[model samples]
Target chain A: MPLPSDIEKSFAASLLDKDGRVPSDLTSYSSPVPQSRFNIYRNNVHVALIDMMAAKFPIVLKLVGEEFFRGAARVYIRANPPTSAMTINYGKGFPGFLENFEHVQDVPYLADVARLEWLRMEAYNAADRKSLGGEDLAAIDHDRLIETSFELHPSLRLLQSEYPVYSIWQANIDGVALSSVDLNSGGEDVLIIRPRLEVLVIKLASGHCDFVRALGSGIALGEANERAFESHEGFDLQLAISGLIGCGAFTGFSK
Target chain B: MTNLSSWLDKPIPARAGVGLKPEHFAEILDTEPDIGWFEVHAENYMGDGGPPHHFLSLIRERYPLSIHGVGLSIGGEGALDAEHLKRLKTVVDRYSPGLFSEHLAWSTHGDIFYSDLLPLPYNEATLETVVAHIDQVQDVVGRQMLLENPATYVTFKSSDMAEIDFLREIVARTGCGLLLDVNNVYVAGTNHDYSPQAYLDAFPFEHVGEIHLAGHAEARDDAGARVLIDAHDRALVDDVWALYERVISSGVSVPTLIEWDNDVPSWARLFSEAQKADRILKGAQTEDAVAV
Candidate 1:
């Protein structure tokens, strides 16, 4: 018979528990001793996965000190154990977890910073494609330009936050000097893309984020212009399109 | 069977190879160090297309690559992870590595992946289970996979066989080569109160295709029992170097790796470690040449 789901969960929980014992039924020995060695294995697994999270999200850990970060991570891990052994992209729910966590409610921007880091990681590993060039844009007749739809680069990701997440990320970087960051400095829109082989996050101007978002959502060029115009009255379509192209944001276009 | 012989039996050059950490992408591309080969965790490169693929493609062109997997769970009670196996096979098919290896340990049980390499009782049950898993993995990848001995902390009372015997039986049954981790032998020996020398002596040297040298952390158990933990990326321990020398004397022409995945020092430090192993390989070759 297959192992029962609850029994398996209990078994895993027992192994991860600080004072829990390995089930006597699993082994043939009669010592009735606690599964101490198994607990060591369990601890190692948890620490390794936690370390991966810590590596990927260093700024998040730095925002919350080591003690609090690990404590919070332990809780998050038990609640949401990895669905796959491949942990390169695991811990996707960390940002949401931080938002709901009551301990760090004072630092409201923690989850947003985590979301930025996760987006950076995602862009770095997103699919590779041939980026559309400026010459391709010239191929279209000027009359057909606004009606054409464009496909954004596979690696393009937009992160809109109500806090200065970019400043938070920068201040906490390894070599950067730490300083008092302003919490109420309004909101920020960030553009994350892997143009070459590395993920680059560029802070977007207040009005340009809507342009990228509209373009990224596969809206027609005319509709994207309308959206950008609505948000920023004098939004320049030429400047935004050139910026997106230079950043390798569009892979191709469709009329 | 097609071109598998050349791959499994090919020799590795004596130059240094990096562990393929993502942090060094620009440095690796800029310097283009004359690295012998690059080794990476198989799971890392399983994605379809990304920076991992780009960097790997660039480096693969310049150096030999090896896929050292940590998640195969070769000794698990349940069936082998077929999806993970298929992903790994796709990678191997894409990049024909000079060597491919997995641990003689399990990591998953009914989808509750204990991401660490958990130990199994070295007995009939485990032996059969691992051998079957290795066979399945090899069949899928279409190549012989090297099995590295686990760096164990504790042994179960139900373990009816020695670790070496268990390894030998697997190799014999599956025709797989052994990735002899001298540090693991030394660490497991110290942990279990056995002789590292005896473990080495009992190892099937002819079947060892590659060797691993890494640093370990030594600590005491709850009951004050001394043991060594194989934390792979630390500074090289003095005794592990001695163990490497002893293994080189075994007359096996095996490619060795100076693995440092944690606390990774500078590129120069990793190269120096590899150079140290290179020296040992040459010394063994020199002695053999003089005897001839």
Candidate 2:
């Protein structure tokens, strides 16, 4: 860490620093390089991460608006500066950042909305695997099915939030008028999966979330069913399996 | 592992290619436009099998492909991220792209990744660092990579040698190919108040294996001096087109690509830019045939 090392550290620091400062060794053909020239590197770094965050969390951007969203994104980008160049993995901590981001506290549901968006992004880029279709699950013998444990798709994500995050995400994504949905209606259990290239965000029924979670954690199908039944009186095993299978949730199952 | 000799062959035909964008993925598959090749940022396709890989697989099957890595930070001050190198190798092994390339710039320092290609000074200490990194990259990826020059606004006061000399020395030491980006030369030349033609005259065209042509945004410095940003949002300006022709005229007819990373245009618009390069290359092809 000598000549170029000292220069890079300061240059990297100035890019993410709250106070805009130019590195000392920087020069131009002219006697003194204009500040704007050095600021180009600064702008490129900030603008790239900001744009990446803005693109990944569109629903959050809509809720907060561009001005506020970008302003907050600027601060978030600095505080949680990416350690990897993988833009997909850059904002994994953004939802948590928004949770404690003071200015958006009035909008208590903002962090949850951000969490839903982050999950959707994760689903989009997750590993590829052929999902176990409903027919495949049905073809299993009834006696063996009970003891079988299911392997969920690699892209499956379950998000439980106190805010009606699914509705907020759905409304914004579909470009529908938000007046139809009440933000304070109730919390939501979201099941996001991408069996193929298409990503699906499903609003889970009361007991299905626990059932799916249990199955995902290697519990036997029969035991998962029993857990679902205990979780809520409205639990219907047939309906839950049909819905999840219809959406290609499970990748495989083993006895 | 790819054979180093075969990697140096540069199998990508001396025709025009376009940067692949997800927005136009379906259209590209459906239309199957006549493109020389397609180049993608290795980081974009580092994601596991999904639409990016799905579409790239389809396109790679039809045409020659090049994987341009934007985030290896080859010129970084610290040790190169072995994980990032592994990711780059994975993508290369999956597709076996015709050309593999990265920048002469560093984007990450310490634990922070900037997500932008930050410029580095051209000097012995920095040169040793870059040469070692490129050597590590070629050894790990098991391929000959092309190193592209960066478009910079500021130069280091400590830089003892010129950019061309640094590039030539790196090529001599590492034996890697060069991806000569015409617009970058124009942009850097104007930004630094240097003659791009002079830089081109000094370039080691023998080691050059590919060409990159793109559009840059015009801006002004704080002192009101003209500065150009490598903003690949729009079409190539007439001046950059001339620079591309100049490179072709210099007997360096290589696989050219039109890179529109920001504000990506329609498939028709992007492909047409590639076609424009094809027209220029074709014109030079006829002249070379006559010369031969």
- Top candidate (DockQ): 2
Model 2 misplacement above 4 A: A31-33, B1-10
Kindly list the per-residue Cα lDDT of model 1 for residues A39-65, writing each as its tens digit: 556668778878878877888898788
Scoring each candidate complex against the real one, what DockQ results? 0.34, 0.70
Model 1 alpha-carbon drift over 4 Å, by segment: A1-13, A20-39, A171-181, A231-234, B5-11, B14-18, B23-35, B48-51
Q: Rate the local accuracy (lDDT) of all candidates.
A: 0.79, 0.89
Task: Count steric clashes of candidate 1.
Answer: 0
RMSD of 2: 1.6
The C-alpha RMSD of each candidate to the native structure, in angstroms, is 3.5, 1.6
Error of 2 at A89 (Å): 0.6
Model 1's CAPRI class is: acceptable
Per-residue accuracy of model 2 over B114-185 as CA lDDT, tens digit each: 999998888999999999999999999998899998899988877888999999999989989899998999
